[model samples]
Target: MDIIDNLNAVKRGKLSRRAFNRSLLAAGVGLFSAPLLPRKALAAEGDHPTFFTWGGFDIGELYQPYEAANGALPNFSIFGGTEEALTKMRGGFVVDAAHPCNVGLKRWVDSGLFQPVDTSRLANWGDVMPELVAMQGNDNGAGSPWMVPFDWGGTSITYRTDIFELEGEESWDMLWDERYAGRLGSLASGGDAWWCGAIKAGVDFKDIATDMAFEKIAAELRAQRPLIRVYTDDTTTLEQALASGEMAAAMTWNSSAVLLQSEEVPVKFAKPKEGQLTWVCGIMIHKDAPNLEKTYEMIDAMLSVETGKFMINDYGYGHSNLKAFDEFDEDTLKSLGLSKNPAAILDEGHFMIPQSQDWESRMNETFELVKAGF
Candidate 1:
């Protein structure tokens, strides 16, 4: 297959990102020439709203309706993690909208960097799941929400079924097993890892902000630190390691396991007996969105069923629009670790509770110190 075909395959989960890169190198493609791969023409910079989001969410599949109406996709900016994105925005970087999960909702709102979204402006607003829209700190008390919910999913262990020997039922302890020490990986972001640490530490989310909870979670993470072969925010690194058998397992989002399985890799997204760390992520309009009208169009397009179907089928994430689940049967949703009734999966998992900016800062700082071998 040609480069364009390989790129499409990677997007569709048919080809691994590592294999796609290998093919590019074997074909004598250079870093500069990589951009020459066939893609829809985009309007000149600044002609459309800029979407600041996680790396993978910037693709065309999620913006079909907006592209159809505007004849080009929005200008895109990618962040490795939400914390990094928030830090940049707080440093005076401006964008039309940004993607952040429910756990950070209160902190984001308290930052005073975003504005309430007028649901009436979005065409798909009514179909958006009420559960997601009603997340803590989402309501502005004016019938508008500070953030419009988009994707929701769990963070858990993605392990090699063929290589990793199971001694018991799946649990968070798999990540801490001494047998797999130095053969495991983890996401570097505390937003995910620290919460999973809370789970493994048996600290309730409601008391996560307490001093005792902080010490317990930090101790758990410090214990896992020596076992981890690598700590990175890049899912590609973890996926590549698992695919090559360099690592037995890694903490990853649903997409990692789904992508590996599509390539026939013997991997499974573990349903820990302790429950997975669940979260809801969505977009918030910047307080100074230069393209307010187009921003609404971007949010509406993301809430469309087409985007939702692609998210579920390709990435194994739950879409906020309830109608998005209509295209998938119960069996398919079950296999993907999802459900038509989101509450079925969401309520069962250890959902993250929003904490204040002070707690978030302190937790992240402590986690960083632990990861640094302090």
Candidate 2:
């Protein structure tokens, strides 16, 4: 179980908050040195407030627009996981906001760890997409809403078309093909690898707790490890490897595939017959979040179609803004593989991480099994 789940259990009389927080710190996600008393913090007096999140997650694309519109640059501290992001927020720290994903949405909201964003304060809410707003959880009509869906994409295989003889054919079985031996790469994260393994084994994502199922995934991974160049989370590194011919294929974000195809890397994003894994990382306003007003403004700026166009033009994933799909002409869309019928494969994709603690623990253990080659 994660810290937030434990805290919820404490709220419902299953565990004590002291115990939860103690266990949380022991997990090495974060630590809060404080008197055991709860003290609520008021908003800080400032025009522009600091922003903190994982370095690559927040920067790179929208930095300039956000900074210019808000009159201050974001002050960032990279959190390695959603668990770590929550650990820092539990202490009422200073950053105005933090970014997590839709999977962690319910847990963050249930903890009272964040405030609902005021809709009226946002000029771009209407300009933003509907599904993205609905994803924010619930609307209270006035306060700060929970997390907002930011960038999104599928966890898919980007294979060299030259390696596969069949054209326009995509399937999970392609990765296990021996043609790319010593030239394939997979993400090192437990969450990503587990999802891929589950998909490959034909186990229904929600029904993935059985030992037989996970064992199959681990076995498959262990079998592939010898052929894998290395496990990495950095897509840029993967791109370099692919370009340099160090790896002929990689399991990467669909956007990475888009970037590669744009550069004419002989790569194509594929949704294998076994399906694909998708994810939408989110941005949420932390309760007692620093720079409450500025945080909303930044989010509003990001919600614009103009900004969405920039993201789609640069990244391969479908935009959080609905209108982004129409931003490009047919030829451009085909060139970038953006013309895909996303739903045809979405029914086959896996879910984000489980919100329950028991499931997360089991997932971590199952992941260890794969990593250790058990």
Candidate 3:
């Protein structure tokens, strides 16, 4: 099928997103795996700017102001992971803006594919978290910001509360528990799973890619292989598996729990004793983007309080805007496993740090081997 046909298939639910992504992966196109919202509004053919992002962010709500001004939501193409998106962009796929996490900020910026963002243009700049604004590589060598920190969340165990019995505070060990073997699931990307294994193996995050750390983390993951029934970047699949008792427990992000619970599935998002694996993903403008003004409008809209509220409450991810926290009471935040203060939560979690390209290549290759029973 053609590109438009494929997109139409996914939009209509006639195709499983994972299957479509796998086909794209086979064709050297990237897959988008993040939470996908059902289409809220579809614009006329080519009426909207294109946003290359994780699957679910194509919703019109986050870009309301942009749509209000331009008369349509941006067209979206999705990728399953940051690395996949980066690879596609490097291979010449262009969009107005792309979403990438801090772990990838430096590499994406250094590739010279993105232009720096002028903070002055973002009306919500003052309300953005300072730490995220100052994240490494967020600054161009010339001092302008290269990325706009947008959404934040943690990677941890999301288990069926009705199925799994806890012995103590929730832990990553629950994933490796023999009792749940064949019923456990995990994300496929080493970007997440390897770090999660590091936490379970007791490796310091700072030493995560070191030889000693790699050995320990590898051993832990090797042991975990047989326990996992599936390894995929498809959050929707994982959520369904958990709800249907196909997965008693799984390594998933906070959104999975929120989405599942919203559907009335009895689930719990755990604050693992070792700590949750945390990340902040944001938007970067393409250096050659055609719709520069509209892109800025879209970026600013995403940073607004309206978008922030949807991100935090509906999606269970933290918003970059501090004012977004005011929309939720402390009790509600706690119930969703979030802190009103993003910094405290970030400091407590095993936040992903920037790594060398060499390290990333090694980890990806090694993890694939480990998954293949090496």
Candidate 4:
């Protein structure tokens, strides 16, 4: 389908925002080439708080409350990945609020570029999940969190069930199988690949910073390098590869399997025997926010049940609001690989631990070299 057809499908709920975005990229269309809202309704760009977030999240659906309160959505700046977002912010490209996941919580906080979110200003704070709020490095030492948890989900194998021959119960070894050497794919980001490597290498995340863990993980990645057909952060590439049977299996997030399933792709989001990498991502206000009050509103909107429902239903992600689960039955939640009690899924998965900046730099550098076949 063409980009216009894909976009119309998104508006009609026949396609997901992420899938539509992938279609746009495939058609060489920039995400911002068309405005999401009518030009007349939008406030002046500078009048609204800037929300720097991932591409799919810049949509107006997540900002309903913010729009209702201010008659316009927050200005948006899209980033391909969290690392890119952080690097841009560190370079003095400021936004009122930025989206970041739990693994980077400590490093982002230590950057001294963000401030703790005040829960009192958020109307939906009471309905927010305590387990998410209690994630490592979220506390601000004053009964508030550094980041207000938004979406949570797993990162694991999204393999073509029809093409991949399962020799045993699903395991992380699926990605390393020599039988599929030239047809496997993986995410390039060390934030994800390195953590998954630790799982595959039997290196405990608690000790991931240790020299032993680094060596083990690096060796595991290097061993798997030749097996990977591609290592990219773009979900579209992986999805397209899987759809065409060019790839047998790939590491992907929850939405990938969900999107593939919608298109009748015989795929499964694997619950590996070792474990899947899990994460919680949320919004953090900049310390020098230009529109401080609206920033709070933007965060509040994200935390609302309306936004939560969309996130849970459309994106197949677990929303931080407890009530968001009320909209789905147990079977429905199970199909999405989520549970009403999020701890059921989160606790069993290998939740990423916060790491020091030095450790992050070292891991990325080492992983890059390994990807280079060194």
Task: Tell me each candidate's TM-score.
Answer: 0.90, 0.76, 0.87, 0.91
**For candidate 1, what is the TM-score?**
0.90
True lDDT of residue 286, candidate 3: 93
Tens-digit lDDT track for model 2 on 163-236? 65544567776667676777888887766877787787777765676678767777777777667777877666
**Candidate 3, residues 256-314: lDDT per residue as tens digits?**
88766655668999988889999999999999887887778889889999999988877
Clashing pairs in 3: 31-79, 31-80, 32-79, 32-80, 33-80, 35-56, 36-56
Q: After superposition, how far is residue 180 of candidate 1 from its true place, in Å?
A: 1.1
- Candidate 1, residues 176-228: lDDT per residue as tens digits? 99999999999998989999999999999889988899899999998898999
Clash totals in order:
0, 9, 7, 0
Residue 37 displacement in candidate 2 (angstroms): 45
RMSD (CA, Å), candidate 3 to true, equals 6.7
Per-residue alpha-carbon lDDT of model 4 for 1-374, expressed as tens digits? 57676667766778765566556545644332222332233333866898888877877778888888888788888898888899999999988999999999999999999988878888899998898889998888888789999999999999999999999899999999999999999998998899999999999889999999989999999999999999998887888788778899999899888777755678999999998999999999999999998888888899888988888877888999989898889988887889878888988899998888898899989998999998
- The numbered model that scores best in TM-score is 4
Candidate 1 root-mean-square deviation in Å:
3.9
Which is the winner by TM-score between candidate 2 and candidate 3? 3
Give the Cα lDDT of each candidate: 0.86, 0.64, 0.83, 0.86
Give the number of colliding residue pairs in candidate 2: 9
